[model samples]
Target: DPTQRGGVILLSVISPEKYYQTSPLTLEACRACLRGIAQLHAAAWENTDLLQKATQQLSKASFHLTVRNPKELATCVESWKGFLQAFEPHMKQAGLWDKPSIHAMGERIAKLAQYISDQMTPSLVEQNDTTTTPQFSPYATLIHGDFKAMNAFLPKKYESACSSSDDNQH
Candidate 1:
């Protein structure tokens, strides 16, 4: 199961308070999460080597998941369309469909794919045209692409436990 795609290894059990999507979260947890992600981003930000490795792993871990090629742009577009269709009901219920930004985005779903293709495609930029240079954004960081409320987790501060000998002495 560890070798499977989407599998995770949780090593820390000393921290009893684990926050998940359904769990009632404190503002501190959210702040801590932001702080942690900021650290993660700072550590890997604009590191092309690390980014490439992460991207390669992501592509290998999924079915038909090459995202760095301009050819993959169509796939991105179709996937977005599929996602929009699948989530339309929920969006409507949540009043997101009526939002101006969302409505405007509905009109230009292909632009997201175009932006990715232009900014992330490995082979070339400008829709694979040779005249354009790779538009690797300086803003690139270790982003969790699939980060969602369902799988979200927040760490809690834990106090170290005293040993049996120490407890006996106390």
Candidate 2:
């Protein structure tokens, strides 16, 4: 329906070229899938239709368990120590693990926590340095926030179909 505001609808896949969740087990396949996702990001960046209709409710860039939430961030910080205690040996066996790397991971959690804290209450955050915050393109873009193996599907080849996925977010 052209009169409808939604852009996407349930797509019926054909017999020969059915959409499947090719869950990118190999490095090259993962790269290809990620490249496909990147294209979607670029295409949807600051699309006028999205901006006009859903800007107010959907301005937040990321929709995750921890993003923009102070308590979840703090919980992550506490969990980090326990995670290290449980998985340090396994991580060491995987190699490339070191004290500095461990510290850096903790530092990232702290920075994100501080960022959320500052955003929520700037008066108390004396070291409210915005530089450490993750940066994105100035233009706001809609993303496949739930892009994963279960949620994303691909045709036999990317050439035959669009590299888009339905997240059912809204």
Candidate 3:
């Protein structure tokens, strides 16, 4: 009865006081986050052999979600508002907000996001007939459904780099 089960030894839970120190999450740290998501999607897309699989769905969603221009979108408006609130002080401090380079970069990123959305359509078909199964193979991949701070463990490199304010380098 005292022997280990399945050759496994269970360890006692540690106290919360022994937890690691909390550090701030920054937008600069999210490049790898975005890349990881893209990699997962690419793997799934390749395995499923579906190209614009939900074309009808995307068309409908686009009808409601479409905007004449990227800057006029509600999300962009909210984003710009938050960006101004968050970075206006920093810009004023650095004297870089009024520069053309920053404005051009912002426009470029906005346009790129819009372009990607324009190219992507629905990848799944809604079922109308119970007798028929969708032709496409189901491709599923592991997803970190909740990738918030609680699920994250800092790597040594990230821990060291976090102290530096060179967000641009990330």
Q: Could you say which candidate leads in lDDT?
A: 2
List all candidate RMSDs to the true structure: 11.6, 11.3, 12.5
What is each predicted model's overall lDDT from 0 to 1?
A: 0.48, 0.50, 0.45
lDDT of 3 by residue, 84-143 (tens): 667776676678778776645545556565444444432344567847744332443223
Ranking by lDDT: 2, 1, 3
Per-residue lDDT tens digits for candidate 2, residues 1-170, read: 31233233346655555555644233444566678888976675545454434334443324322344556565776777777777776567656367677846765876775544333221212235666633333454555545876566655664222234322111
Our model 1 lands, by Cα RMSD against the true structure, at 11.6
What would the per-residue lDDT of candidate 1 be over residues 100-138, giving only the tens digit for each residue?
676555346556545543344322123566465334466
* Candidate 1 lDDT for residue 123: 26
Worst 10 residues of 2 by lDDT: 117-126
Top candidate on TM-score is 2
- Pairs that collide, model 3: 54-122, 54-123
Q: Which run of 10 residues does model 1 get worst, by summed lDDT? A: 161-170
TM-scores of the candidates are 0.42, 0.45, 0.38
Choose 2 or 3, whichever is better by lDDT: 2
Native-vs-model 1 lDDT?
0.48
